[model samples]
Target chain A: MSVLVFAETTGGGIAETSLETVAFARGLDAEVDAVVVGELPHGAAGELAEHGVRTVHHATGDAFGAYSGAAWATAVQAAAGQSRVVLAPGTPRGLEVLAHLAARLDVAMAANVVSVVPDDELVVTRQVLGGSVLEEMQLPDTPALLAVAGHAVEAAPAPAPAVGTVRELTPEVAPADLVARVVSVEPVEAVDSSGLTTASVVVGAGRGAGGPDGFGAVSELAELLGGALGVSRVVTSLGWRPHHEQIGQTGSRISPDLYIPCGISGAIQHWAGCASSKTILAINTDPEAPMVTKATYAVIGDMHEIVPAINEELRRRRG
Target chain B: MTDVLVCIKRVPDVGGEVTLTADGQGVDARHVGFTVSEHENCAVELAVQVAAATGGRATVLTLGPAEAVEQLRSALAVGCDDAVLIEVCEPGSYGPADVAREIAAVVADRGDELVLLGNDAADTGDFQVGIRLAHLLGRPVVNGVRTVAVTDGVLVARGDGVDGVETYELPLPAVATVLEGGVEPRYPSLKGRMKAKKAPIDTRAPRSAPAGSGRVRLLLPPAQPSTVDVLGEGPQAAAAVVDLLERMGVAR
Candidate 1:
């Protein structure tokens, strides 16, 4: 049986995550095909060919102009005629559409899966509780529906490129399926700090920052370090930080090279988001806090005083 | 008047290391406290607000063990007018699909036009039930929503999409999985607590059989070996931190 992957697009090109997902599908030991909804992204066919995708199903029309989970699922379902296994990127839209597709097909789907071995029963390894735990799962039924987690596999080209023949289809979508279509889109608000998930270094603040006014030192440190600012769940819940900057289970998961969390009592939820970081330096007055104990480096002190000192030291070293 | 049904789950408040049970089927909850997830807290808050503004009934539901009544009562204390618990033998063992089916069976006839749930359960992180339930009930769904309100029979749900803040308007009989940070979940007052203590919980058994999601085991990730080097104490540690940063190639 063939494998079908939903190719998600961004900025007129295929998303990096979708390429990674295509690489993931190639490892499934099956002929890989792709389905792209909306306008076919530029250079998408050539890119899929390099990734060993044999067929590219392009589903586009007036009905596909807007983002509708149900309508998108219908297109994906229509395209997934012969493929028993379907995969999508573990992104918000990908997961949403897969959930809708799983329901429409009346099948069980696994989300954020890192590994899968197809057989009579599909064996999969998936991250749960925000990557802190790995669960080995089995899909008992046919047509194993899965959402591949972000960055689970490296994006690579095949040894030999495939034909990448493009096929077009007009999916019959009912008006009822477009019931939840997007009405409007408000542009993203400008934030002072860079994107947390894409940053190389992240400076995190938590309850130990004292209060909203206490973020001055840590904010300055983040700027001086040329890094983004991140905060723990409590910071957002307390309104000290915005939701986008919160690095925790209910927030963004980051995998930066260096992470310095100040005054954060590393709860499991918070750890789940930042655990993927390569190096962690925790600053907390309580040495026994989880953040301190689990960190590669720990400083036993108040962040209010320690952070500014670190900034001063950074400046001196730069001079 | 619109009726709002908020579904919640009782998850262990995992503050530290998550320990699995002897069977590896569930989390070892003996040491940790219990509470709903952050997203669920906001869902409960939104439900209470919608019910209050519309002069409608707000009901809390859960397909969990008998102890989940605690979560139900907590929602009641926060202004939910009613509670329903579909008691199960093992709540953790139920997959997202099974949970959705059970919920669909429970609320299908309740005439609840709006349903709210956490974007994903705190423990399982399935992120499937809300959308699945919507499809099962033939209602429209929107997940990862931060703000939602029903006005003149249309449910306006706004969420952070991949590109920007997405707004979706669905007709009555809809589902939304809420993410935290939109609204502040209020604390229960003394009077609300008293009423919740006396609230009547309608408990029942699940109608559908558990269709396993094929989960064989839950394994904690191998711990990263970390020996935290102490960088002195107070501001005295700053120089040492910068030195280390220099060594790590982060400091110029």
Candidate 2:
């Protein structure tokens, strides 16, 4: 059985998550081929070959320029003619495309899958409620559609790289598929200089930050640490922070190396997003809070006092 | 005028602890209350606004046990003009495809032009229903949409993407999965609650056979062993924290 992987492109190159999905597909005990909907950067095919992809189906046209879930799914379906299982990155575009394909083919599709045991009956472990719970599921049908969650597997090249053969495939897209294509894009006003998902250090604020004005010290500390500012769902709902900056289930999932949550009680929903962090430092008045108990280091005190002191200490050390 | 339909699901409030059922097929809700997800709340609010602006009817629908009517009633209290309950006998057994197929049948029958759903199910985290329903109905769909507006028979949906704010415009009869924080959801007024108390809910049984995701069991992830070191207390702990940060190489 051959596994078909969808390689989502970024800046003309393959996305890192897509590469991770390819790595996951390589472990499936099936011959893996990949398909790219848009233009592939020169020499990127070698990267896929390094990851053990045997064939690269390149589908490029003006119709594929803009992203439409339906159109991309059409291209992927046309390229998945011989594969028994289809895999894609757990990114938004990847899930959207696979859902469309599953609907068109009248099959079940699983999203955010973390583990897959490939047998005649495929058993997979997937995240539910934003990783707070794990559900073991079986994909009993052929050509099973699965989206591999981010960081499900590490992306690495094989010991011996195989030569990747590029084959052109044309998508038989209908006019209806292009209806939801992107019409325009504009840069969003940044709440912080760095993105929360990619930041090495993240400073999170919560209800204990008091209110909208309470974030001043927290913001300063984040700036001093050169980290992004994230918030609890309560903070967002209270209109203290934008929805994009909320870190939890139904929000952006972050895996920073150092996550310092100030004045936030670590609820299960919020924990789902940051459980992958390497180290957690929780600052709260209540030492019995879930975050404080789960943190690598806990400061049982008021953040209003502790944060400014930390900022001052950092400035002194820098001097 | 375009009629708006908002799809919602009843899930555990999840404010406190989350536990699994004895069989592991569903969440154990004995310790918690139930409500729709935050994004679905925003979807209902947006639906009500769009329907009012277009002089159209705003309808809320769900596929769950009879108790899910509470969610529909809440939406009605906030100005939804209609309610639909496609009562499912085995609530958790209806997978994304089954829910979409059943919802598509209702949409086709009602001739609702615009459909809205939460970006994903809060309980199962399934992201396929909106996209699947769109495909089944042969309509354009956009997910993760935070804001939407209808003008001149075109639907303008905007959402935040990795790089920036992305906008998509589709003709009428489109679908959008909403993310919360786009608009403020209003509280139910006393009069609205009285209205909702008397409102008639259109309830029916599932017309299609069950085709659920083959869920074997639910399991909680192994807890990370945490040993918290008390890094001093009060403002005096700043020096120690700075030292730890410096030792970790995150701060100089």
Candidate 3:
């Protein structure tokens, strides 16, 4: 019952990935502990306690700078203390911290873990080759670091005992290790739009949206659905959409409740990004298009006609 | 002059339908064509460009069977000065940890000021190697670098962050994982290909494989039972589309 989870604080609260990570650790049948960097939001400890975290650990130090992978990993590793496993979400920051932790622990760290089995050996199934393949890694029977894939599971509360006790500890850091502190991270100014990653409904457009002006109906349907718009790599490459809107191996990976990809052939790269959706609805004229074959629903028609028709149906129902 | 080393892998292009081996230990690459991923190809291109400007030699390295020589040759064709193949008899035998170990040894001996790799290998798909190698060598590393350059006495690596381009400046002797963005990898010219064919490539085995081999198996993910319900067609079937949406609980 010894597992430590990094509950990454975001916007002064725990991130969804942190909660999902807590849920994942609980599933391992371990005494889950959490590391809260800043002040926990109101009722957050109770929320974590609800999910089997008995002890909340935080490091007290004014010296640790803002969001550097070096300081953060050192701080978390101090709390990790002899835990059989340490896990975090596979975000850029999380992976960086976990990598440093692995080097310190001298244990193999596995990323993009889909599932873990506590067999005779610690067996981990991970998404490899940009989610094109799944490989099983058998680790040494010892402490391990694992970064779970995004949206691998939903966050649900664990069986409650009590709200966890908060503990203050200090991490010993080598001055040299903190040399490369992240000065600042700024987001590029993006157009006003729904983000592709967290959107519940993602309507993806591909090259088959026809020409640059072919997305009118698709945009109308998206507005009606009140969802985000995603695009395939070809759409971005052709300058029809920005690269930030691309959903593929080299772009944003999304896992919406429902993904409706229009005029997309569903190449392997595009499929890798969106394959985690709860449901997929593909609209393509080609019956043999890979996207159509792999979708939950397929509309074999021009997207110009199908999208407008879908919009019309919604409008009629609303009326 | 700062020597630049770029680590590249030859992967079975996962373009169309993918198949697994009979034993399910690896991708069924027998029939599939092989090529360096765009990510790695761009890294090699960057190394060559950077080395040319700084008067450094660019070395391309890979850990795979002798067949990977073809890939090494491609890197040479595109302007890399030399190549190294850490030949392993069994493919997929060396995981990320092992690859990092072998590369780290070579870097220690060669003393390259800069090392570049694809953010993640297209086949193994692990992002740990660059960071792992950096940790071992006591050097700074920035992953997912879309652009890297030497400016103002420091190496500034810029990658797309959540916001704007996240920039990091490090002293010489650093590692970076390159992503494809600004640089489109160029094809090898006929003269360059001829030069690459005769380029000298060093072949060696890892001094000693690191401990704790963790790979148990490689297999394809279980196929989901696909039921693609045809939700009508064209504009006339809007009625059916509405019905289908309502059934899925998305449309009210």
Number of the predicted model whose lDDT against the real structure is largest: 2
Worst lDDT window (10 residues) for model 1 chain A?
A: A186-195
Model 2 stretches with alpha carbons more than 4 Å out: A191-193
lDDT of 1 by residue, B189-214 (tens): 99999999999999888887888767
lDDT, candidate 2, at B164: 79
* Model 2 lDDT tens row, A174-242: 999999988998876663346888899999999998888999988888899889899999998888877
Q: Write the per-residue lDDT of candidate 3 for residues A152-248, one digit (tens) a residue.
A: 7878877566478888887777775665555556566662257778887889899888778888887777777778888998887677877778898
Best by DockQ: 2
All candidates: DockQ: 0.71, 0.77, 0.55
DockQ of 3: 0.55
Better of 1 and 3 by lDDT: 1
Clashes of each: 0, 0, 4
Docking class of 3: medium
iRMSD, all candidates: 1.9, 1.6, 2.5
Alpha-carbon runs more than 4 Å astray in model 3: A38-43, A60-63, A191-193, A210-213, A312-319, B162-164, B189-191, B210-213, B246-252
